[model samples]
Target chain A: MDQFTLNLIVVGITFALYIGIAIWARAGTTAEFYAAGQGVHPVLNGMATGADWMSAASFISMAGIIALAPAGGYEQSAYLMGWTGGYVLLALLLAPYLRKFGKFTVPEFIGDRFYSGGARLLAVICLIVISVTYVIGQMRGVGVTFSRFLEVSTDTGLYIGAAIVFAYAVLGGMKGITYTQVAQYVVLIIAYTIPAIFISLQLTGAFLPQLGLIGTHTASGVEFLTKLDQVVTELGFRAYTSDSPNMLNMFLFTMSLMIGTAGLPHVIIRFFTVPKVSDARTSAGWALVFIALLYTVAPAVGAMARLNLTTTMWPAAEQGNALDGPAITLAEIDSNPELSWIRTWEKTGLLGMSDLNGDGQIQYFAEPPAVTAANKALAAATAALAAAGPDADRAALLAEVAAATAARDAALAEATIGGVSLAERGWVGNEVTRLDNDMMVLANPEIAALPGWVIALVAAGAVAAALSTAAGLLLAISSAISHDLIKGSINPNISEKGELLAARIAMTFAILVATYLGLNPPGFAAQVVALAFGLAAATIFPALMMGIFSKRINKEGAIAGMLVGLIFTGVYIFLYKGWFFIPGTNMLADIPANYLFGISPLSIGSVGAVLNFAAAFLVSGMTREPPHEVQELVESIRVPRGAGSATGH
Target chain B: MADKSSANAYWAANLRTIGISLVVWFLCSFGLGIILRPALRGIHVGGADLGFWFAQNGSIYVFIVLIFVYAWRMNRLDLEHGVEE
Candidate 1:
């Protein structure tokens, strides 16, 4: 069959299966819809969490950032450090306690714990900001991945993704999503692994899969990773694994991601689905194992694709080449449709081309000024110094010449070449951003020339990834609206059926809102994703952790902490990102310029989280402690075995 | 008070194990990745600095081992404290 037909058939079948699971496991009661009735098996819940945790960004964008950056940037590790570290805080502080509290939702926990309606409302606002920004980012990623891979426009792909999520999420509820997410994890892991296996065999000639990456290359005796590092570095990018940003920024960014991950409403809610506290502990371990299978292989895929693309471009060099490849030659890229992403993106102006010598072949060498007056003056100075003695600074002459040569060479070289050009490298360090990071995982099969089904599996994995996370967020939003707003605060007398209907309506509204954001995405979808972590870091994490650990923390303190946390981090990010993440309108122009003590806004969330904790602690310390009964409850949550049953609220 | 001592022992043991595990966790992602990356530059793995391995893949591998240790050590700690279900 043709590639398109095969992709359709494979992707369609996967969609049908997801919808089938949703219908089979559909929620009947409000509890079932919200928390899957808290009866999920720990191991199964682990798999579901993996699906919930690995979004379109994880499945589509992360490896791309790794591949594209080769050099780690300030915000790039947001995927690695943030996503993984969040679990530590989750398992240690949040999960067992929240599960012990037996609350229906995070806001409900705030309401009961703080004994103030204002605390609950503050939580809702924080949830709306964090979850909406995060969910919208996920939606945009889903749309972009779907459009590119599924052979449909982004609008069609988004609608298709939304419909699929609705069919399962609205129908199956959490129970359905939980069971289906396990299957989705299986589908996605297999889809991701297969291409890696083929590409590994094609490149390394070792078939064992995992060993192919680090093992010596079959074609040449060189290590695969070593060759890849050398190839991209010669092209003027940082080495794959060894790239570093400012230490303070890196430290804070990782912490922000971890805090954000731990704080994310959708991911945390997944833990509530499991049966017992002890099971919750075991389940977390299992989720990591399931996720690690991909995380371990992802870096390998990234390094290997870098090598593979270099070899393809520089075919004459055979093994890995030091020379400029076909990708640099304007004639080769423009004439070849297969390599047209280079041209398509070049027109976006993020990638540009220049012919210094009017040569049709674009040279991509380091173009330090072939010579400079400084070089001449320095040469005269060096000649004098050398004549004077051995006093000449050889290092200075070399560096100056190299610097001058690099500038001229860079100017002489094509302003842009293909296969992720030199300039498209970092996170907010440059003037414009590149979407190459998002394309990393999605473009894997095509880059490797794998089979149609393999490519479609990537497409399917992207959809499964995007759809599952979207459904989870919709569930969180609708739950807050129906349970917290309608039942708890606004009505106080909502019927079960009425609440369920409202939940479904609220879900529809949430999906519509998400879809609008996806279609005409708020100007800074990428920047917003980072801020989602920041906002979560600043607000929910402090409240939840404080509530469980400290009896002195009161409703007023929690509300005050969340509001101050939101405003502090929000204003800092807006001032730097722009009043509202619009690019040119940024109040602060320099990335390092605006960062406090050289801490990037992307990493500022960690500082905000700390501030949140301090504000809550100080404010609570000054006020009254929880009632005696609440203190006993806090003590009870500290242990594992004496956990109470899930409350209906 | 006697019951509280055993309870304290159990909790303390669990806390100790997590404390040590978190130490390793922090060292791998933070210590190696950021603070001590420069110091460890001379130690090469594959073709990159040792710190690079820690940042990209080593920390995650260590994290896997850390969780499993917590599980094993906690299971034993449970027996000592009489807290195991």
Candidate 2:
């Protein structure tokens, strides 16, 4: 069978499996719907959490981002460390205590802990906004995967994805999502690792990508990173191992992602499903083990993919003679079987090339500085020629033009590759113009010439990653609406059956909103990720940490802190990313020079978090302490003893 | 239930463990990975320096180990303090 049919069979089977799991594990009560009946095995819950946490961005886009980072990809380690490091915080600082709290939702814990309906309502709003924004990204990722693999329109793909998530999430709730996510984790991890293992064996003669990353390339006999550094620097990029110039920004960005990861409602809620506080602790470890399996391989995949792409463009680079040889010719690109992946991806419009010098060969190199200077001189001479008009010193002007042309040629000659002038070789500019970062992972197997099944598995894996996270986020949003908003406050008299029904209705409504947003995706979908992470890091994380760790933090303090963190982080992001991400509304350009203390909006969350902690402490010190029972409640959650099933009230 | 003084001691031990673990976490990720990276330029790990390895790979391994260690130690603490579920 062809690639499409293979993708269809693979993706269809996975979809059937998820729907089957949903049917098998259909939730029966408010408890089951919200926290998977509080009976999930630690390992299985960890696996499910792995699937829930590693969204399409992790599976499909993370390695790509690392591979294509303009500054040699080393600085992108922020993402690698930041994302996983948060699990450390989760396992240690948050998970065990939250599990012991025996709550159905985060807002429930916040409301009761703070002893205020207002605090719970604020948390519900924060949870909804964060999860909703996050789910939209997942839906878009699903659409991209389906459109690329199944040949469906993005809208149709989104509707199909929404339907699948609705069947699983709305039907089975957390129980269904938990089991399906375990299966998803299995599929995605297999899909991710198989390619890396194959590519590792192909490139470095090491089957293990983690070892292969540091191993010597078989053909070049150079260390993998050394070869990568040499090749990329030859093409005018910084060395692959170069450090980021702004250490503070890197620090804050990593911190933001770390805090954000721990704070995300969808991820935190997974802990509530576990049987014991101690189980919650180890479950985090298992989740990290599963997550680390991919995270460790990702850098290797990125480095190897970059080397592969660079070598494909400059075939001689593999032999350590790139400068002495010609770039890949258009004829070879057109007819070489190994290069067919380029053409196939070109059809998706995410990858493209243009031959500006018309030499029929792609001269993929950074423009030499001399050529830039020469171009400037040529432009000046041309303007002078035009200014002379028809009468004044026409021949002199012509001579000036000739001199400028000669000068440009001389400069081009001085700028040589392997002592051969670019002008002599008739090469002008880079040709591989549009390499979308997503291609690094999605097109990876194709680039390595892996089998059709592997490619199909990748497609299925990307869809699974997207769908699993979407389901998890949808569950979080619906539970917040139904459990926190409605039953907790709006209708204190609501029956358990009525709450379950309301949860299902809220889930359906959430799916509709997510699908609509996915279909119409605001132009600022990418920009709003900063908002999701920022608000989560600034507001929810601080509140939860204080609620569990500090008995003195009162409702007044918690409310004040969350509001301060929310508005500060939100407005800061809006100032740089446009007000509420609306186009052309930014007060300042989103650049380092304009940043506060060189902290980019993406990194401002850490600062917001610090400010939140300060505000909470200050306000609490100035105001009355939490009630005696609230302090005792804090004391109780601190221990692992007597933790029972998740309770609504 | 454990007495208030025993509870306080348990909490302090837990805090100490967390503090120690966090120090390791910060040292690996931020110290060797970022600020102290240049200082460790002489120590090589395969192709890159130890700092680069820590940043991209080693810190994650440490984090995984740290969590399991914390869990194991805390489990023991819970049992010793008669707080085990």
Number of the top candidate by lDDT?
A: 2
What's the residue-level lDDT of A350 in candidate 1? Answer: 28
Clashing pairs in 2: none
Per residue, candidate 2 scores C-alpha lDDT tens digits across A176-261 of: 66787889999999999999999999999998999999899899998989888888887766788998878898899889888988
C-alpha positional error of residue A460 in candidate 1 after TM-score superposition, expressed in Å: 0.9
Which residue runs of candidate 2 sit more than 4 Å off their true CA positions? A151-175, A367-427, A493-531
- i-RMS, each model, one decimal: 2.9, 0.8
Top model number, TM-score = 2
The whole-model lDDT of each prediction reads 0.69, 0.83
lDDT of 1 by residue, A6-55 (tens): 76787789878876887788776645655663676667778888987777
